[model samples]
Target: MNIIEKHLAKAADLEKVSVGEDIRCKVRLVVAHDVTGPMAVEQFAKIKIEEVFDPQRVVMVIDHIYPASTVQARNMHWILKDFTKRYGTILYEHGQGVVHQIISENHAQNYGDIIIGADSHTCTAGGYGVIGIGVGSTEVAAAMATGTIDLEVPEVVEVNLTGSFKPFVTAKDLVLTLIGRFGTDGLTDKAILFTGPGVRGLSKDERMTVSNMGIEMGAMISFFADEDKDEGVAQTVAIELSEIIPVVACPYSPANIKPVQEVAGTEVTQVVAGSCTNGRLSDMKAIAEVLRGKHIHPDVNMIVIPASARVYEEMEKHDYCKVIRDAGAVLLNPGCGPCFGAHQGLAADRDVVVSTTNRNFPGRMGSREAKIYLASPVTAAKAAVHGRFVDPREPSGGGEN
Candidate 1:
């Protein structure tokens, strides 16, 4: 069994579970942030539960509307502050970073631990060999109160990667290719367990990117196998990194992927190179490599947000911050910026943005008339310097790496 299956079975005190069986399993962590936190607290209130089963295991992140967008958002932050203090739950303040990145980077490090969050992208924690499950607010409240949640055992799909990434290619490229080939709903009701020799070569940040976007393919969850994992057999597929490029998911749908070259020259209004999906230090280094000495187009407004306060400090210390600023990209304090229509980078009518964030549903980031193309950090950075859709491998943005 994969880590997810093993954790679930052990939690439920079952020897094993068949693929479709519904099992009530223990939740090691009940993670929620500002956008979903208030609703979860309300649900927990409905249950008349004054204290969580394990306050230490509950994490509250004030990320989504952090820096407090509206007065209502400010009030929401206060509620979370009170709840965390009342329950002694771990509270991550605004400017810390996106919840998914924060947990995977700091809190959710134990292998085989089941960390469930109210937000869908919580599955990003699965990259660390934990079973990261994203659940609804009601389920989150129930888990907080009872220390357990029920879930149907999902079909496990083994994705085998078997090649090294070429220069300018990052894990985001591979994920984009997967979503493009499978469409947005291809992996519905399934859990993906990535294994094979190639999988081990990816950095932790890269693996996180893969798991982070699993939901783009409608997957129940996705995780990387342990480095020493020895599973017998299961349904599987293979992908070679040599076949991938700095591709992008075109306007409206994450599944509507197209080659960067195909969309080359398409005008862009902005380029974002951060978010849970591609906001790690490695991602910053990748974009900086492409933007080493070139200034972004005057017409383009480029934003780069580190995944966490720690990451931001690392960038500043290493001068990655200086490099990006020198390249004419504005680096914001660590937070989720315009990834989900929050703030810091809204779009206008007919605006076109090349971003490293996940999900490109219509009206996701801004105006319904605006468009978003999902790509890797370097790809988006390259486009920022060019002010249009262009492959990072191309020569349009200053000199090549």
Candidate 2:
């Protein structure tokens, strides 16, 4: 078996391994943000849970409203603070960093672990070979109480990305292209296991970009290279560390396969960059490089939001903020924001938005009539400048530095 398959088999084995015949099929790590934590705390109170199973296993982060965007947001933070303190849990405020980043680096997400977060992009942990799933606030609270959560073990579909990515074609573009090829009906109720030589060449950030969007296809979990093969049984379920060629999957049923090049040149009305999927520092740098000296087309409203204050700080430190701002892109905070249409940058009726976000389901980013096209940071930036979906490899009217 190849590296990915080997690790997956180990993950399956760990799921079956028993501690004195008490089979632990679902090993869980619970996560919640300010927006979702308040609700989770309320649910925990409802259940009358005296104490969490493991205080160290739960992570609470206040990222959706850093600078406290509103009175309601401030109250949410206050409630979260009180709740974590009562449970003797770790409460990561604005200073600790975004939930995704902190969780990725946290010791709790070791290989073969099943992690569940209230945020949809929680699957980002798959980059490290853990099976990550996004759950509702109530589900999160239950995991905190029971130390386990039930899940339907999903069938795995292998996404074989073969060829090397062309210049300007990033992991973001690969996922978007998958969505365009399969629409929203593909890969429903499946776990996407990204394979192929192409997938092995990607960085951790790039891998996160791909797995984080498994929700777009309604996938239960997305897994990549395993990291635990060398650490004996303890680390045997971790993703294999290797170079991956960037690729995306659009699993339409169990038989259909399509490539993004087949649907290039599609038109769009808006272009967005940022969001948890493509709001990392590398993603922002790619956008700045693509739109350095160019201005966004008047017809397209380009919006850029960093995933967290850490990402925002990195952009400012690297001067990426100035580059994008000067190019006429509207910048927003680190919250889920436009990805869910919770605040500004809502889509118009029947409008198509080319975004760097994960899902594009009807009404995901605003108007139910609106359509969202997922792409890489580079593609979104280029499209924003050209007023249309233009492949980043193609020359623009005025080349970006």
Candidate 3:
């Protein structure tokens, strides 16, 4: 077997490995949010299971309904609270952070292990060298009961990203470029392995952004760097703290990846600079630094949403929030809101929107006629300030100052 097959074999072994083995495969991490936890609880109760395999291994978060967008969602939150409390599950409240952001930062993922969640982006954990996938409530409940879930091993595709991205071009752009090149259906059911020196240059958050959107390409998961080669099969991948750099995905496809100097003629209707994809502090800081004294153009409506309340707090603490607001951008709460068109940053028919969120499928952000362009936070910020897609390397103030 090749590198990917070896990793998959290790992931499979995790289900039956002894607790004391150098490989920690039997241990599993289960995650759920308010939107999916209630259903998971209901399913588990129907199976007549009184307790989960282990409460400490389960993580429940309440960011989906923190301010309670609706009465039904609020009720769901309450049910989640009760359910998690009843099982002594690890519960992360609004202040603890968003599930995705926390999971990436908390050092919870073990290489060669299987991590499952109710959210599709659960695949984001692949950045850490784990075999992560999203499942339905019933599947989640089953995993909770038996401590294992069935999955078909997927074929792996090597996505070799070469050359350094110019400033303002982010991981978001890289993935979006993939979508444009592959047409969102090209890599269906495949495991995308991001390789090459460019892939190694991205930060954990940027890798998360790339892996998180693998679903958009109809991929089973997007993985970065081979962890098995770097550490013991049971060990976790050690992130290089010094090599981390802020990145964003731009709107073009891989075939159309151009230096920032070449995108000076593109036009845009809206510019959004936040989402689970690129809404972290580093992402925001990159945009703020680029848009520092500049104001958003009057023609374009710029929306900036933090990934979580904790991220919001950090931004405010560091004055990045003030910098964004001063630049005439509208800030939104941290949720899957606008990313899915449920609420916030909705667009009109035929309106073009440039966003940092994952997925740009038809009607993803709002109307079917709305055209969604995905890019990095810097590109989005610079576009919002100019009412068009101006390359970040270009001088601010609608081109030349």
- What TM-score do all the candidates reach, one by one? 0.96, 0.79, 0.82
The reply for model 2, stretches above 4 Å from the true place, is 1-23, 26-28, 65-73, 95-98, 105-108, 179-186, 227-269, 350-352, 397-401
**Best candidate, lDDT:** 1
Query: Where does candidate 3 stray beyond 4 Å?
Result: 14-27, 227-269, 396-401
lDDT of 2 by residue, 1-401 (tens): 43433444444454233212222344557899988999999999999968998998888988766657578879999999999889988888754456887677555556657788998778788876787888899988888888777554455556666556656557765665555454455666566677656666788889888788777777667787532122112112112222221222222121122333434555667887887788888998988887787788888888887776777888999989999999888887775666666655789886778777766656777787886766667667777887766545555523334
Can you write out model 1's per-residue Cα lDDT over 277-352, one digit (the tens) per residue?
9999899888887788788989999999888898888887887888899988888878888899978889887789
Clash pairs detected, candidate 1: none
lDDT of 2: 0.69
The per-model lDDT (C-alpha) reads: 0.85, 0.69, 0.69
Using alpha carbons, what is the TM-score of model 3? 0.82
lDDT of candidate 1 at residue 140, scale 0 to 100: 91
User: Candidate 2 has what TM-score?
Assistant: 0.79
C-alpha RMSD in Å of predicted model 1 compared with the true structure:
1.6
Error of 3 at 92 (Å): 2.4
Determine which window of 10 residues in candidate 3 has minimal summed lDDT: 230-239
